[model samples]
Target: MKLALFLVLLTLSMSTRAVLDDCTCLVDCKCKKSLRPGQYYCASPDVDTDSQAIRNCNRDTGTVEVPCYAAPNVSCGGLPYNATQCIFTESRPCTFVNGKRYNYYLAVGLSLFLGMLGVDRFYLGYPAIGLMKLCTMGFFLIGHLLDFLLILLQVVGPADQTGYYAPFYGPLVSRVLVNGTDPFIESSSSCTL
Candidate 1:
């Protein structure tokens, strides 16, 4: 019983004399010399507006305080000064195709070159007439001559047939003088204005 009592007394004395080596100091401790004059003191019991201001402050953070008042003179950096609001503009889909019938003059030129052989007429979607022209040697060469005359009239016109010729007569005249392949033969339809 005496030994038990002694052990209990020894344990109590050891615990009482134990050193707290790992204890940490509070950041707002009055002991520090570098503390700011208006530094936030979290442990203070005074809860007021200035303390609330410290709580609401986010200066160190990236958050920005947008001004409630709109400045009339203020302009977006690179945009026009008169432009009030910024809007994204997109292109409307294209609806019109230009010069869809650019190949009509080409067909007329082809008819002149191969009309005697009916090749031109055949390519022009007039197979029956082409066959007849072919069988008759371009109508005993008379039909070929008439076809040439018609093409010529259509091109330059008889000096008096002014309205019969189209505006593209210049290219037709040039093509005739050059007399190359019929460009419109491969096309499904001759282009016309």
Candidate 2:
């Protein structure tokens, strides 16, 4: 029984390869010799080398679906990105698609204006330290000076729904410096693969 099963599997494998070899592309897109019919594969116009073969391919009157590997760095908001171009900057700033960049002018103005009183820190959700700064005049003397330095460097901001840094100064600065870009657009219509 075991020998029969093994023979059958081997025959099936050989037959599958033969079918793949005979497969032809009906579309005019870039073609790769390694690609077999009923199997999926990626063809890049820019690159000369062929990528890994896809497991399967299926098409219908409405749409042609193939398990094409997603381009790298491409992401759909929080979803995993495939392949997309990304830019990096030194002062990482938060940016959404459609060219919506977060503003830091208000924080800078507030910090410079009331930083001595830790008002900026409070605005950044550090109420505990803000209170301390308010009471002791930013801890006066050495403490005050250090705290002032920290505020000058702009080390504060909003929290997300989870109460974590929704938009913090450090991350913002880093993103700006890196100048990263995500090609995977986030759209209501483009949900779910």
| Candidate 1 lDDT | 0.38
Candidate 2 segments exceeding 4 Å error: 1-103, 141-154, 161-172, 175-193
Per-residue error (Å), model 1, residue 70:
43
Error of 2 at 138 (Å): 0.9
Global lDDT of each candidate? 0.38, 0.37
TM-score of model 2 (CA atoms): 0.31
**For this target, which candidate reaches the highest TM-score against the unseen true structure?**
2
lDDT tens digits, residue span 118-180, model 1: 765665456787899999989988888787677655442322221222332133332221253
Each model's backbone clash number: 1, 33
- Runs of candidate 1 with Cα error greater than 4 angstroms are 1-105, 155-193
- CA error at residue 67 for candidate 2, angstroms: 16
Backbone clash pairs for candidate 1 read 101-191
* Alpha-carbon shift of residue 16 in model 1 (angstroms): 99
What lDDT tens digits, residue by residue, belong to model 2 across residues 7-113?
55445444434343333323322322233432232322111122111222111111112222212333222334222211110111122211122234554555666
